[model samples]
Target: MTRTEMEARVRELLVDLAPEFEADAIDPDEDLRQQLDIDSMDLHQLATSLFEVYGVDIPESERADLVTLRAIVDWLDAHVSR
Candidate 1:
């Protein structure tokens, strides 16, 4: 998928998982964990949810790379299966 599509999907997943989060307020460069009030479990859920929707393996080693919205988009652009 294109970067635009991936970015939108990432935001959609975040909102789907955490309805209280301000999806539009998420900073592209800031760490989302700190931007929002979610805990570790919430992050795990986010990763798994993204994997389910994108068919991507967000391995524990690579989870750190998904800290920000821009990072998620860039990471997926490189890792997503065609």
Candidate 2:
């Protein structure tokens, strides 16, 4: 899928994960933690959900690399086969 498609998918995942956040307010370029006030546990849970949904594993060591929406998209883009 294209980057734009990946971004949209990521957004969809985030929306499903955090129903408290207004979908339209999520900034694709902003830090997810800061924008959404998500805690570490919430982040871990979200990552796990993403992996389950996409069938892609994200190592714990690299979890910090996914600090923003763009970062998650980039990680998936790099790890997922075309």
Which candidate number would show the highest lDDT if scored against the true structure?
A: 2
Instruction: Tell me each candidate's TM-score.
Output: 0.85, 0.83
lDDT by residue (1-82, candidate 1, tens digit) is 6788788888888777678876786778888888776678988888788778878777889787778889888888988887
Residue 25 of model 1, lDDT score: 67
Instruction: Please write out the lDDT profile of model 2 over residues 1-82, one tens digit for every residue.
Output: 8988888877777877788876667887888888888888888788787778678889989988788898898898888877
lDDT of 2 at 51: 76
lDDT of each: 0.80, 0.82
Candidate 2 residue runs with Cα over 4 Å from true position: none
Question: Which segments of candidate 1 are over 4 A away from where they belong?
Answer: none
The number of clashing residue pairs in each candidate reads 0, 0
